[model samples]
Target: MSSYDFVVIGSGPAGRRAAIQAAKLKKSVLVIDDRGSVGGVSVHTGTIPSKTLRESVLNLTGWRERQFYNRRSTDNPQTNCAALNSRLSKTLLHEVDILEQQFARNNVHTLQGRATFVDKNTLRVERREADRTAVELVTAERVLVTVGTKPFRPDNIPFNNRTVLDSDAIVSDLTIPKSLTVIGAGVIGIEYATIFSALDVPVTLVEPRDSFLDFVDREVISNFTQQLLDRGMSIRLGCSAESIVLDENDWPVVTLSDGRVVRSEMLLFAAGRKGATDDLGLENLSLEADHRGRLEVNPKTMQTKVDNIYAAGDVIGFPSLASTSMEQGRIAACHAFNAPMPDAPHHFPYGIYAVPEISTIGYSEEEAKAKGLLFECGVARLRETSRGHIMGLQSGILKCLFELKTGKLLGVHVVGEGATELVHVGQAVLNLGGGIDFFMENTFNYPTLAEAYKIAALDAWNRMAHERSGKVIKLKKRKVGKKAA
Candidate 1:
């Protein structure tokens, strides 16, 4: 029998970060995950692989140069699969190696096995070694369940790992289809659909809803939706696949609720994901997950109904980005150990690694209205930036929303090249409660896309003044750390 101060189940972003945080506080930490599954979905199937594939597609297809050169690099037969997978394989290995090193450096013990709850405080790990299996029971004062999630495969989908696939299977099994049809307009579905379209593959996106990405500002979505249309990607909304059957060529033929028949060489169902908690033995603790297999937890502390049990990551649902999950894990571990920690974040950034990329922080325009807050929207197109021209970008925008009366920065939204990286500057300003004045007054590098913030702020400044409210006060820049000259 082995015991530890903190026993983290799953070695994904959440579990790994929580275990390390506890270890730093001098607690005995053990992280349990299935054999060879250290990096979880993020590294293996979700975030890393998808982003790498996007990068590979861009490079091979000369996507970045298409605007300026108007000519693409010659297509290589190997690019269909070999070229993309080669880089992905190398990247995954390096990422896992670094994760293992972090564990070893922090003295965070990791056990390879399927972990199950023996009780609220005890866990049974069934370890498989070659032809034999070993079972071990471990006890901990606090236990964290962060097993993450798996793709939701419907019984009727008829996935064959060839003509039909799920988001998880596509990470390794995907070959550039002659024509691809993706069901679902959620982040994962849009990402894969756009990625293949970037390679000049004919991609048709089918969603049951009339609109998708409802959390994003409508203007941003309009821009993104237009981009997809311009790229020859077909979108079917307000309907669902009534039935999917294989044709004479073994291709997927999908009939929609609207009486539309769509046939594609391949179909990808990325409608949703379910929590990987079914086999976790949560019933022993009288814990139940929602219909989607998501756990209910105190958002403040990430604690489950059971006092000593906590859950984080996708298992708990919403804002399931690996970035947020890491922070949640850290917070959960600190609270479990009664360690002093920073207050919860004011907001978190959402990045969708699609063709052009979309990122947002804080309240979106729709959210602001729903909350009954008055806000002003300021927008700047990337084409106005010299950097955009240098990079041959034809479309991109940075939008800022300010509290109408006080000029307080309420949100930032962007859709374009490098939008994910660009949103951080806005995130910092929003977190500090900085307003439009900060953007107008701050000195950003010349000829950079960041200048869009200034352009946008000035636009909002004009509007705020039009309302004849909120005086712009000149403030001095304070150098906090450096010695004065």
Candidate 2:
């Protein structure tokens, strides 16, 4: 029997982060993972693998370089299954090694097995693979569960991993289908559909909902939708698969609710994912997971029904990016150990690694409108900047919203090259209560995408000027503090 101050289940972003945080606080920490590896699904199957495949496809096919050379050849990249996933395995191994070293440096112990609650403070570890026949029990003063989720596979969808595949299969047992029919236009489905499309494989994206990614600013979605359409991807919204069956040749023939039959060489069902909590024996703790296998917790503390236990990451649901999960894990660790937690940031950026990247932070246009905030928008296209020309870029937009009364920055939305990395500038200013004056007054480096910030600021400045009877819009003067770097 082993006892520790903290025990974290599922070595994903959340669990690993929590374990390390607890160990750093001078507490004995043990991390348990059933995957038999340090990095959870994010490294082995989820975020990293998918993003790796996207980058690999982009690089090998000269996706960014296409504008400079033979567009036809680069547009239709030739690749096989082995070459596509060759770097993926290596990347996962490297990530795992880094995580393992971190744990070692922090003196955080790790156990490999399935973890189930024997009681609120007791956990039974079934180490079947680690040792042919060993069962280990560990006791914890506090616990964190971050098992993450698995792809939702409806009974009607035949997930054979050959013709019909789930999210996991897209990374493992992957084969380039002659054509692909991706059901569910969520982040995962959209990502896979576009990845294959980049490979010149025809893709038909079907979503039951009339709108997908409703959280994103509609304008960004509009731009992204146009990019997809321009690239020859078929988007069928408000359409669901009525039936999915295999034909004589083992291809998936999908019949839609609208009475159209779409037969594709492969089908990817990435509609949604449910938390992996069913086998965790939560009944012992009187903790009931929702229908989706997600646990409800206090957003501030990450505490569940049990005072000594906490839940974070995808298991707690919504905004389930690996980045957010890590934050949630750290918050849980701080609460568990009664450590002084840092003040929460004003907003977190959302990054979608689709063909043309889309990243956003702060209130979206829709959100601002719904809140009835007095706001004005500024816009800049990437082609409007010198760097866009140097990069041979085709399309990208940066939009920023500012309150009409105050010069406070509301939101920043971007679509195209380095959108994910470009969003942090907005995040920092927004959190620091900075305003458009910062962008207008500050100088950005020449020949850079970052200059789009200054460009967008000027656009808003001009709009504000025009709206106010051609009078200059000046922010109210106040006591000034030192500026942020």
Candidate 3:
């Protein structure tokens, strides 16, 4: 038996960050993961793998170049499962190696095993070597559970990993089909659907909700929807999968509740994901996970019911991006060790890597209206910029919202190329409490997508000036009418 200051289970983004943070504080840290390697799901199956695959598809198929060329020929490069797998493999290996080295340098010990709670303070890890099985019991002053989540596989869906697959299997199997039917319009489904569609494979996206990406700004969503439609992807809204059956040829035929049948060479069911906590023996700690297998934690502190135990990332649920998860892990480690935690910003940017790409931070017009905030909006189309002309991008938008009275920037939303990377400028302003004036005052590099910020700011400034002038004229008219009366 060995004892340490902190023990982190599952070396995903959250676990890795927490362990390293604690170790940096000179605390003895042990990280336990079943995968036999660092980087966990984020590096292996989820974020890195999917994003790398998207980049590979875009590069290999000349997706970005197609806007200008418009040439369709057999000589054009095509991507297959092998090529994508090769890229994903290389990327994952590099990421894992970096994480492993980081852990070693920080003096954080890592054990490859499945971790189960012996009690609130102790963990029993099971490991298997080539010819022997071993068990190790480790005690810790604090524990962080960051096991992440797995794709929800419903029994009704016949997943053969060839014709039909879940989100995880889709990346591993890596087959390019003639047609694909993706169930669930969530982030994962939308990403894969668009990736395959970009490859010129007919894709049908089915969502049970009437709205797609409802959390995103409606304007951004509208633009993204149009981009998908323009790319020839079929979107079926407010439709649920009644059943998935195989035809005589053994291809998947998805029956919708709306009396529609969609037959595709392959199917991807990415409805949702559940936390990977089934084997952690939470019952021993008297901790109850939600129906989705997610553990509840204090939003600010990331602490569970047990004061010393914390949870982060997908296992804790909501805003499960690698970026946010890393922050959560750092905050959790800080709280666990009683370190001074910095104040987190009220707003964080959300990035969706769909075909056209969407990124947003702060409030949307609809949200501002719902909250009864006095707000005005400014809009700029990418086509209005020089960069858009050079890149042949006709469809892209940068929308900015400002509070009418104070001229404070309420939100920034963007859709189209480079939206994800370009959103950081908005995030910086929002975090620093800077308003529209910041964009108007600063000079962005000319002929760049970033210049859209300045354009949007000017639009809002003009609108505000016009409204103010109109109000003054109305006041003068009212005074004149009162004097005549």
Best by lDDT: 1
What is the TM-score (0 to 1) of candidate 3? 0.95
Q: Please report the TM-score between candidate 2 and the true structure.
A: 0.95
Worst 10 residues of 1 by lDDT: 476-485
What TM-score would every model get versus the actual structure?
0.96, 0.95, 0.95
Which lDDT tens digits does candidate 1 get at residues 180-233? 999999999999999999988899999999999999999999999999999899
The collision pairs in model 2 are: none
Backbone clash count, each prediction separately:
0, 0, 0
Q: Model 1 — TM-score against the truth?
A: 0.96
lDDT of 1 at 100: 94
lDDT by candidate, in order shown: 0.90, 0.89, 0.88
Residue pairs clashing, model 3: none
Stronger candidate by lDDT (1 vs 2): 1
**Comparing 1 and 3 by lDDT, which wins?**
1
Q: What C-alpha root-mean-square deviation, in Å, does candidate 1 show against the real structure?
A: 3.9
Worst 10 residues of 2 by lDDT: 476-485
